[model samples]
Target: MDQETLPPNKRELLKQISSPHNPKEESLGSSSHKPSPKPFWSPLSLQMSIQEYELLKEDDEQCLRKYRKQCMREMHERLSFGPRFNGVHELDSGEAFLEVIEKEHRLTVVVVHIYKAGVKGCEVLDRCLDCLAAQYPSVKFCRINAAVSGAGEHFSDNVLPAVLVYKAGEMLGNFLAITQHFSDEFLATDVEAFLTEYGLLPEKDFRAAGDEADVE
Candidate 1:
């Protein structure tokens, strides 16, 4: 190989083969060619993301609940088919009372008040029923004198100011001497609450009651 490095190409190959290998240089070269790793999410950032997701989920659930309630209210309004009566009616004869109870709409709740003219709480109950009838237009409120009911013997003066609730031709409740449940003086609200407690009245429709009041 001493012929002035016999040939130019051969001399160059011999020189590369004679050079020393460096592990550090090889490692540096390999590292420089590698692709960088993606950064990891911090713990705080991960927790915050979870909290944000939970809040959004809760918001969606709340919206869904509100939507369902709105739909139910609309359906209820559309399905209500009962007749509305704004004031208490008076029955002069037992036959008329029977007709009202048997011939009214099946869904209608009929409340009858039995009283004698001079009974202690008869007038007060009458006034309360008038107010209740106005508030609950879906219910039919009626009043009949004990003597006029043709059952005067059964409904004596002692059991005056009685209340009878009927629906679909079935008696749901019968309360004799109903005034004994209230104080000497009571408001329409008292009667309404009492009836509601006994499950005798339906949910109050404030919207309809308000509209009726506006008309008057």
Candidate 2:
């Protein structure tokens, strides 16, 4: 195309070609035409410096450590003392049984041994509970004479040595004549093992007691 009819870009190219070639001048011209480099710090990086980031990360780690320590302290306190129950109590009337299981200790677990006066197994269970009561003071242990307690209607000669476990006013376990399930010679440890397996009792105390006994 004629110079006058050429496109603006072509006209510019022709002018560059016609100009005298000087390596020093060309190099300087090209460097000036190149785009300026980006700044080292972005807008976001300027907003949050490295020191601020480090401080924030450190605060978060401290909070996490504090929360962990608080949790561990609370758990240790719970395990140290646990729940407290006086030794085995003998219920005299139906009202007394109701009070122990429903009203007075409804929020706690109540283990009741229903027994007849003549059953030998009942005697063994009573002794075992007495020992267990001392070992686990937080768990309520009691006995209701099948013949005299107002709950006599729920018991009979066939149901002697029956054990009922209640928590929060609900029956969690109903073991009828558990002596029949184990040998007549079974002890409190056997009863503890059975209850632990059912998740009714925490197992840590048993292990801790064993450790203490071994050390002694």
Candidate 3:
């Protein structure tokens, strides 16, 4: 077909078909080098991502706080040098009672229960002291029978359940006939409350409390 004799549209089409195929001149849409469309971020999707990040961060902070508390508790236990006793000691003689009061740590609070067997409240008081001893390790709890205390005449049956609080070998409290302060049937907590009222008991040891909580 002669170019001059063909229709204008046909001549144009023929020109396009005969043109050299230059890769660089390809249509913009067909080019593979076009920068990828900027990633579309929807408002709702962005908000959800932010919320997730905040939740994760909060959890991390809580974990860190618990870890720090545990570390502090452990450090406190390691650094403490105070004497710890878990149960009441039964003194065989008055000299043994004196030794405990004088030889224990200066910071120790010594609670001596001068009790006599078969007394109305002596047995109950002894049981209460046992419970307190387990709770307050820093406090030295001891029991001595009135007959063996070398002062049986002074601590008669009327004062058979006397309690003597000592610190550094000095008596801080002298409660004779201590059973008068409690009901006939009492618990360890009642005894603790009574002593606390007079400021006779020391503050609860933090390390011991933490250990108990862990156990629970």
Candidate 4:
């Protein structure tokens, strides 16, 4: 084909005219054009700036959904290896307490073991369980009543609402100090501070908790 109609072999001609024998410029051309491969650590990455996290976190619903999934995964893992709490099971003579009281962790669990005796029993247990589940993953939180525990056999239908915390099966502290009408704020915040005082819990572990993995 005539030169006018022919397509140019740009690389070849550039090589020829630029002196293919010249080592530096040809290498520069090659090196400058080729993209670099990404590093391997990206799959487990935290290269994002705080500004980026704050920006993305603006979508509260999506952020919350992501967090919930992460928490469920961690909870499922704990429950799989061992029955972490008795909330979902039939309690058997403090057998549940055996696991609940023991901490395979560096710290102890300062808990408020509530009994199921009233209309608000579930609400109380749920709020505490979910709160501890998400925010205090390090500490165990449990609820057992006069029906299924060794302690319940004695106080079964006799005791007033109480708050208790134990460390190594020895009562570290308590606030049996509550009466019929009490503030939820005091229950939550006070116990949080108490746990922190004994070094049994983190002030907040929600961020430390794993991202919601698959619950199942």
For all predicted structures, in order, the TM-scores are 0.62, 0.57, 0.65, 0.43
Per-residue lDDT of model 2, residues 138-215, tens digit only: 678899888778767777777778998888788899998778877869998988888778877643434345446446
lDDT of each: 0.86, 0.77, 0.85, 0.54
Clashing pairs in 2: 83-138, 84-138, 85-137
- Say what the RMSD of model 1 is: 10.4
Worst window of 10 by summed lDDT in candidate 4: 82-91
Q: Candidate 1: misplaced stretches above 4 Å?
A: 1-77, 208-216
TM-score quality measure for candidate 1: 0.62
Ordered list by TM-score, greatest first? 3, 1, 2, 4
Report the CA-based lDDT of candidate 2 relative to the real structure.
0.77
How many residue pairs in model 4 have overlapping backbones?
Answer: 6
* Model 1 agreement with the true structure over 26-59: per-residue lDDT tens digits: 6677553657796688889999999999999999
Q: How accurate is candidate 3 locally (lDDT)?
A: 0.85
lDDT of 4: 0.54
- Tell me the lDDT of model 3 at 209: 74
> How far out, in Å, is residue 83 in model 4?
13
Scored by lDDT, model 1 comes in at 0.86
Q: After aligning candidate 2 to the native by TM-score, how far in Å is the CA of 139 from where it should be?
A: 0.7
